[model samples]
Target: MRRSGCGSARVRPVLAVAVSVLVAGALVGAGPAGAADPPDRVDNPYAGARVYVNPEWADRAAAEPGGHVVAGQPTAVWLDRIAAIEGTDEAMGLREHLDAAVAQRAELVQLTIYNLPARDCGRRAPQGELSIEEIVRYRAEFIDPIVEILAAPRYASLRIVAFVEPNSLANLVVNTGSRYTATPACEAVLARGTYLYGIGYALARLGAVPGVYPYLDISHHGELGWPDNSGPMTALLLQAATTAGSTVANVHGFVANTANYSVLREEYFRADDVVNGQPVHLSKWVDWNPFVDEVPYARHMRELLAGRGFSPEASVLVDTSRNGWGGPARPTGPATRHDLNQYVDSSRIDRRALVGNWCNQAGSGLGQRPATEPEPGIDAYVWVKPPGGSDGASGQPGLGQPYEPMCDPYYNPPRGSPYPTGALPGAPPFGEWFPAHFRQLLANAWPPL
Candidate 1:
């Protein structure tokens, strides 16, 4: 989930030229062999789904011994290069990748666009290279070329499942109050005005790309499960669509739990009200508490959006990449430790601290593989976040960096520290292979490696 850092002052000149060249090349790249007229979208563009296998990820998996289990796993390519100097490189790479897909006659590709200004809400690692004042440049230099590539007739036959800006809107919901959420970056954008408009611009551009299905990122249940946040969250989404100069119909759907580790379900069974030893309802879990997982979250969110004029075709895709808790459940009674791992009820166990925990979490496993089997209002359960890449620093703080809450030597009690443990320390930067996390994931894979 790292936002690639900004360019140093000395490298700005070089980066400027590189970006220009990248955009030029993408707009003029030779059309694919046997390119035909752009494909039309009379029905759902993604209805015929075949997930793309990212060549870069596959190559990495094959070379890393610990990545054997993930070697052939279909992972995604991120557009995190947005606003960074490397954006040009990523754009060029995407054109090349699309060409390769055309050559292979592949049907789908998972592409995540993550470089929004004030990304990660001014979080710990991978602070983006760009600033709020630079968002104009973001759209002009980064998104424009991306749209050109996707709209090109050469790629119209390929379905691009574009996961848009993972944490931008979610951060707005969870961090509106700067002091409480510890997100000064988000506050800065809100105070300056036009933050929502920025989102609108991205969506509008993406909406024009015929073969691209844009799924706006919404934070998971852990952060927005309360009834209080639901209305505001829904309103924020509506604003996003309105400001984008687009309607809900322009978007294919929304994506939840992107790169976050909230499991698909707790060990609850009954579907009627009073299920899970909680209140009785269609969703089976009471809304106010942290009990709502992704399934119920998507169901409720979609219904709310539909009420606001979104197309019924607007759906959801949850990232089931790391929620598989293959380990034994926590003790059903009292916990011997005060950390957040207390057994909340007979059937539910609290795993990570909250939805905000994005680091390499302990005891998490690989979830069900990418699939199109419909689940309630969910369009599909896909692994948008590639497995094996480190979430962030896990070991000792790198080079004079102080210890952070997310990394290893994990704070005691796990909920915000106060206790201690013997767990491994922090990990490498984002996108780099974390051998320890990779092994743990494979070993704990739900169906077993």
Candidate 2:
């Protein structure tokens, strides 16, 4: 809910300088309680890093009316700005993005680590074209080139905030051995740990870069939060570290809720909710009373990880782009309807079948803009998932394989009919813009867009 005036010509530079100072302060000496400080003791992660804002964002700021404010302003992109590395994407688009960072002499530029095999569980529209069998080659074709670019000497001074593989690690915990693994594709991914290997290799390689701050993705609270999924998540992190041949020490931090939406603070105030004579908050997993928001979730996970040997210096990052606009006003009583998102219980709001309501959900707003501020074990609140881009298409007739009841416009699962989530019907694919979503997001923006 942090607010700032519109992106005026006079305000942009101030914003940049403020951001630089913020990033510099956090990297140098911020460590969790009782953690040993690193010996290197660099004051600024972005110091001397050759980073710049992308020219496209600037151009849009100049030409696209409101676009100049949202577009040209900094937001991270994957592989290339548009998510694919083909054609001019590698030659021209990437250079443009990097060149802008350099032009502005930005201290940091955000980048996403996508392309894990069997990516997104084949559940969403951008499920990736790679099969589990072809993952080894995926490393060669997709990941390596990006690494080569980041590792290049020309960009040596730039601080790269690498957001590793959104939804990749969480999928390992949620879908691996469950009914979701019904397909051969899911089975292959589970058997091979395709995501773990993919993310591990990327982390080890990218983390080695002097200017890179590698943050592996830990899915949001809904997918793998406290009480329910704690043990499995701890084991997964340890396994991932082992697979990478690097310990948590090599990582700069871990990111949660990359593209998903789960507010960082739950509604419960006192952190005391008794269930069957036991306070739920007292439980190791349910560290936050109302519900486990990203802050407590990240902090608790860090503690759990420390017992297993994760670095205390490793920080947490949360993507606050869309979660700021809480979904429907908190329901007053038990849900009279079947749609899970609206269903509420006494202990918490939105007791849906799934904790995270991803999928181009409706009523979301532009969250806290990207910035580094130390709060509750988190390093920064970033807009890793660009605002206007669509999560997936609403189930319009022709789209293949991935369509589900949640996104289908004509069907509603509760009544044995399917319906799309609010913001989705008009959205495009993964990284493309959706004007409908843009209008809604701008209108619903927390600080009043």
Candidate 3:
């Protein structure tokens, strides 16, 4: 299965010239003492930078009970459709957000560039406006405008991190073949090569902007952790990086679990643990996947990318937005049971019925608050997927979002082992705020809000 999930300025005369000189010097890597460094010069864009806190998201968060605790924290601004580039009825436009970022004096801004043609092709919760044949429209109408905004002179001072199309590549890996989970939509996406073209085009155009760093999304551990899936996924990434006038140089790094709820780490159990002569990988939960959580999966994926001639400096980012499985049910230690399945289940912190269940999960909690260099290969643990945004509607269809059985808490898949979706009830459509879910996250925050 596939997982899925801006601004401006002004000035004066002499004072403006002085500000312009400072900014230009910084951009060209010729700044004097204390001037900002060029984006290429920075090893980690997040380092020593104030992450932009979108006031729009902050307002929504603050309105909820106990939401002030995380209202000020940084979350990504998602441009899911072309309309979001210009202001929508419900949200600010790309330039408006960049303008707000400038006003906030934010050193870094994150944007989820997610409007690829046939996006989320494997599922139907959040569908894109572009048809599979609309790659030109995707390039001209969607990515090109965003690239123009990002490349504009006024936003040069801000380090813009563009998460290029989460799950777009990963879907090409798992959702296209004759595998049980494959769908015709995904097959069409693969057959037409739209996802690769769209992603490569976005990366190349965005990367051309000196201030924009594009991090392609590799889906979560549950999706791409297996050897077969990870290998082909890396290959597909390289293919995309080289397609449409792009190259590996265009990729600054990659982000994993972008809106999925896979745990950042399983503190108690591991994939190699042995119980009664049976390995943990044999368990239904582990299912022979080498990774048990996102951290290892991300680090290993980085190695895979590097092995395939990606930049050795390419770092990884993990979405810690909602994978904190901290609550009374969270396991404090490994299980004492000798049975492999029992040991794996009792010791795991990811409380989802199945790792494949990507939705507004019932017991998920707020994970690690955004932090830089939290792990070896990880540049930052970020709230890329804002906490409390519904994954999809549970049952009924919403305006653009079709009803997905994966989002249904009561539905069981035909192929995967039968289990309830474990999704929270009353979820709104994807990207809509769910106040009850927000309260649940706050209450069960891992580090304790």
Candidate 4:
């Protein structure tokens, strides 16, 4: 969705400083709260299931987002709560400020590391995706440090996830807009097979932290089809990466999965509209958003992985700051023209549309789901995108900016509601649809998560 609607409540710097002091006291083992219950360990979807939650952005200041979403709380006080972040949007380099912020918060973080060299993934899309010929050079230029991080002692546990190309190699294939498939010779090979191999190669050469692994957010740059070729895609990517270096048959897993099952519901405008399928099915992507059909997808993904003797953990982080909540409050017809880029700011490229690879929307409320089933492993559902970061022209280009001013604070419903159960002043209904639509129009733009 485009980054518009439901503006935020700014978190003043003074309050942020105060909170930092309080949080720092706790970390040093002297807070009145007394250690915060060891951080609430839950059932491990992958035995050590850990969900990564990136801070809003270094520029926004944790204090601001904290004061916004966590309102009344100083971000400084919650610095230790940070887990991971999407370091950059372009195929350039990591944002040092964002990196520092993540490193400061979570002991580990995932930097949208890439394998594209002599070619850009996002910025330079038509460069033939990522060529095998460039793999070595790509690794030399981009992957060296990830390996070091896994081996580094001071930050041995400090980790990063190499989500090769904001779009997986699958995006390289013709047609399907990078949506996965198990058919066709080339598509299957590039996605279901080679991709993972490349990841493993990076891991072997770069070394993933013992507790960490390289994961594929395959849908980062494209839409997904049913019976997602996720299993095969994962296998191939890891196989390619590992085979490139390791003999251990090291398997790379998926960190995020797509659940883009949306219903095209319509609001009643006139009785004639329904007769002609006016309001209903008019919008195409109505009630459904990324997590709309997630559980089913997860189940399928789990079955596929487990069948291959792999137990993987997936992370469900929401890009909440600006996704339009409230479902399809209005109705649209088949030609209704859904706009995923509604919040995009044409004036500036800083639009926060969920266009391609970003998946933390408000409607996907899996965070509140209790850890019941474990067959298809899932550790935790977290708020990946902090609320209040302007969609476009809001933050730094590569390092996306936070929803400025403040976070639109409100309670997200407990569970199983079209929207989160609790009330959130949250952005408008389906406001995020615009940017995604905008990106889709661009031949090079990727799809929303």
Best by lDDT: 3
Each prediction's TM-score versus the true structure: 0.80, 0.75, 0.91, 0.48
Error of 3 at 130 (Å): 0.8
Worst 10 residues of 1 by lDDT: 19-28
Better of 1 and 2 by TM-score: 1
Whole-model lDDT values for every prediction: 0.61, 0.56, 0.79, 0.32
Tens-digit lDDT track of model 2 for 1-449: 00011111312344443343223212222321111222142433433332334343233233433543444345565662223443242233444555545545555677776767667655545556676677777778777777777776666656677877766666666655653434555556767787777777877777677767777777777667645466777777777766756556566777777776666665542245444455555543343434456777777777777787877666777877676663345433433433222222333433232344466667666666655554646667776776666676565655555555454444443422232234357555555556676555665555444
TM-score of 3: 0.91
Expressed as tens digits, the lDDT of each residue in 170-279 for candidate 4 is 44432223534223434443544444455556556643345344444444212442334354454544354446665332334443332221211112221123322234
How many Å off is the CA of 412 in candidate 3? 0.7
Better of 1 and 4 by lDDT: 1
lDDT of 4 at 160: 41
After best superposition, candidate 3 residue 306: deviation in angstroms?
0.8
* After superposition, candidate 2 runs with Cα above 4 Å error: 1-52, 55-72, 80-83, 86-92, 178-184, 267-292, 326-354, 397-405, 409-423
Error of 3 at 41 (Å): 3.2
Instruction: Give per-residue CA lDDT, model 1, range 339-418, as digits (tens).
Output: 22222333443355444456777767787666564555666777788776766665554556534455554555333445
Q: Clash totals for all models, in order?
A: 18, 19, 5, 74
Query: Residue-wise lDDT of candidate 3 within 1-449, one digit each (tens)?
Result: 22222111222223322232222111122222223445554768887677777666666666678876777778888888888889756567889878876765667789998877777883567657787888899999999899998877777788999899888888778876877778898888888888888888888898888889899888988989999899999999999999999999999999999988899889997898788988888899888998999988888898999999899889688888888888898988888967788788889999987888888888889998888887688889888888877778787444444788877777876656477888788877777888888889888889777
